[model samples]
Target: MNTLQHGFQLNYGNTDVMLLFEGQPDHLVPCTSQILLDSDLFLVAGRMVGHSFLHGGPALAGISEAVVDVLFGASPDMTTITVEDCPDLERRQTIQLLDGNKDLSEEEKDAVWKLADMWDLPGVTSDNRKWLFSRLLQHAVLGRTDKQIKQFRRGLKETCIWQLLTERKDVIPLMFPRERDVEIKPQMVLDQILWPLETTNEDEDYPVETRCRIAGYLREFIATASQSSLRGLVQFWTGWEVPSSDMQLEIVQGSLPKASTCFKSLRLPGHYTNFKDFSQDLNACVATCDTGFGLV
Candidate 1:
């Protein structure tokens, strides 16, 4: 039996095998026959053995033809593998293998999670977390049992999956629908409308259009809003003082023409003599009038 530097060896049973080490504090790692046979190391060792048999090489100088055939032929026995000493590399290889295998058994998945925990691995990487999330989402859409769904939710929360889900605008509503809330806050809806306008990278006119549309929406939203919601909207708009175009200002003012009335009627925060006084101050700070008298 000859040993190679790269952990390859020709065993007495005429099998070509490559030793694999896994995990930290390296030990002779044993694995299932299927895992060992399916591994890249085994494939590479088989190729090397076949190449050696086809062309006379120094590595095969003393090996018998029958031995070479057995090593190179189908149904090669890789069971007599020795322990190698590269635990970190082997562990990473195992992780990549497991991560790529979407059809893993429940036991296999448990093993993967255990390995991740042992390594203190954060599921922040796309490769590490995407598959798990995909599986969880599939289970959710397919109507898993309540207990199973809760387990998946717990796992996702532990990995900060909600933060990632928020970035996916399409999935956020599905995962966290407004209907789930006992009482949806008007500020949350307002924030949703304003967030894009504040963070947009488009031309300045885009924000003007967005703000005008938001103002119109708010006006309609407040019409059916609870007293508390109306108060919230008034309090929010009062602190906003960015200058806008005349058309944009006009549309926004048109939407909330009765904001001051609502504030006073509800006894909301902030003091204003009347709705006209509040409207004048807001319009002046937000945009100039047709007469060029208000702040531009």
Candidate 2:
């Protein structure tokens, strides 16, 4: 396993130099490992509201859910980290680090901290998570879904950016056109809508097959997160008036447009009728888009 070199010096401010060891690095400084520091900083800020740090690059993507696992100290891999276990085997160590000076029980520690506070962290913990998740959701919507975390982390920022759309009424502009009753066909959803945004994707070409795979999974995530069917999720994405039932059939028959691709493999319902019912149910679902709301 790749490990931080012992006695390595990471200078912070003018007065601080963090000392890393083979076993565990000091919590005060940064490290080369993305998951370790990212997980630590998130818990510290969410629970204590004072500690913060700057993180960059792809490794620290999905810091919020990762840290929640560490703080609650549970190893169950769900939506956040897909691996059955963390590669570093530091989940236990991570828990110890976050327990800190508080005397409260571990479960109490988790119950007290909220995701909104996590978003408020004044350093890279908040910034990187925001950027990472924005990228991930963007890839999913635009048709570039990922199956493995190592790959999906690449689009974390783009994914979270799209999630921010539901944050308020104003987000309607960036995601949906100003006109009402505008129903975007799957192909049109790919070409006309998602690709235009340069900020959402990396500056490189993407294959259509890859885009389709991503979109399929992303659609499932929307249904799962929204707790509705495929149809309801589409309504949420477009903000347009509901299309006729026959129109829904036409859209379903067509290929997945490039506008809605992702890198992850999303679990979706089997048939068209089921998807329609799912959408109707999703439309009626209570709004649950709070930051980190669907992470589980």
Candidate 3:
């Protein structure tokens, strides 16, 4: 008989072996030496389950679920293995291993989710859950048929993930299109349409019809937006000096055609001159208006 490092005796066949319980310092358990020699059993040194047999002492901490099932025969009550039982192991490795397998199944994904939930793993946590949700949403959106997109959208609405769509700032355009009959706030729609127009390169390769549609959308939105929002938008895009409420209204009314004409002209080549003219017209309007305020 040879004693293993953790005070478990290794013996073959019918030989007697002694096992020490680190939790019970003074007690020893007797076992057939065949248990040590079982092909399915693997002994790992660390803490066992939730408790250490001996503080800072080598203990049998890691055991495969298969090994436990085989050792216990027909009944295995252990449902979970925690970090304390396998201090050297990381749950991410198991998830990654599962993810890498080309033949992954739904059951395997569920198992991964279960393990992540048990371990409180990062990939499945609240903060990172959006990554998974967005990928699924993207897959659905890019599906070949309108029926597929509509089906996926309907399915999503029935799940908790639908609530997350509203909370995601980066994916609003993907989830809600102006052409779609979905119910979305007007302000959100306006912001989405305006962002690319304001931020993108003027020479960028966006389709002219798209630009005209955005312009038309903006024109309609301005007609309905509160006077304060109109005033704010004018100051934001034109860098005009602040105007009194009456003058602000007048500026908004006068600028509507300039905005519309600029967007419509985008459909033609060399339309850059139209934008230049629009800017000059705006400056002339502002200067003429400023004279009435005695501030020119």
Candidate 4:
């Protein structure tokens, strides 16, 4: 907003019209309208008319000179001309002009469409413009099941969601699977069980904390899958501390179908007091699945 102030007032009536000279264009002096009057710099407005002689000046090249000349020529003198120039006007004008032109090929229009979308402009209105941009930026990174990812994608912009599925670039190498990893199968088993907990319908009613717990458990299970060994994965989640022996025994005693043979075989050295206690412990283990010993 800070700009040069005018230095003096000039009379448009007293100014003489001069013929536009073409040679040495760059050095050609700016139009009198370009000169600031009264305070510091030039002003363009209705007062300065018929000065098309200034049109060919090099200073006007690469500018909105044509538009400015057309709009302010008749009133240039009284126009409150500030000295600051808009640097992005030319590029913006080019984009606007490209969108306005209908003669471009479909392919060329697609490119322009992407540019407009990237710049967050309204000009790109092709039926699949938003979808196309999303696919182009897609990267598959997460190793989550397609269903889990579908949920994640639902929360993201349509244009960015496909990358997680199509590209598989979301999975970090450190977390990528390796051969002979028994933990992978077990983690898959855990995920298969936990995935059902994540199901939610738009019309279904549930407490906010329950939803958060489901999401947190799923994310934790996915994170733990990246570890190399069962002990390592369990340790990563359990923080290497042993779970309570009585709680482990109680988990073992629970006749619930949800409890796995693996949970029984690990011979967890603890007793859980009751079914409620066991269920709470199971949820806590998965909830704190990333924490040490699953105590949390």
All candidates: TM-score: 0.15, 0.16, 0.15, 0.19
Clashing pairs in 3: 22-53
Consecutive 10-residue window with the lowest summed lDDT within model 1: 240-249
Which residue pairs clash in candidate 1?
Answer: none
Ranking by lDDT: 1, 3, 4, 2
> How many clashes (backbone N, Cα, C below 3 Å) per candidate?
0, 47, 1, 49
**Against the correct fold, how does model 4 do in TM-score?**
0.19
- lDDT by residue for model 3 (1-296), tens: 01221354445555344442211111111122334324212222111311222122112322233222222222222222222222223432344433322554566557557665554443344345544433322221121122322332344444444445456544433322222222234443344232334334456544445445445544464456554354334433333312212211111212223322212111212132244454444344334322232112
**lDDT of model 1, residue 281:** 46
**Poorly placed runs, candidate 4 (over 4 Å):** 1-108, 112-183, 187-276, 289-295
Query: How do the residues 1-296 of candidate 4 rate in per-residue lDDT, one tens digit apiece?
Result: 00111122345576543211111212211222322322212223111111211221011221222123213122333323211221233323334334332565676666655655564544444454444333222211111112222322232223332344345443311111121222244434344332223454554344434444544443453444434333333332323312212212111222221222234222221243344543444444444433333332
lDDT of 4 at 174: 16
Report the lDDT of model 2 for residue 41.
Answer: 29
- Give each model's whole-structure lDDT: 0.34, 0.29, 0.32, 0.30
Write one digit per residue (lDDT tens) for candidate 2, span 154-235.
2322344424433443633322222222333444323322321123244324334444444454455443542133333433
Q: What is the lDDT of candidate 3?
A: 0.32
Q: What's model 2's TM-score?
A: 0.16
Where does candidate 1 stray beyond 4 Å?
Answer: 1-182, 191-214, 222-296
Instruction: Give the C-alpha lDDT of model 2.
Output: 0.29
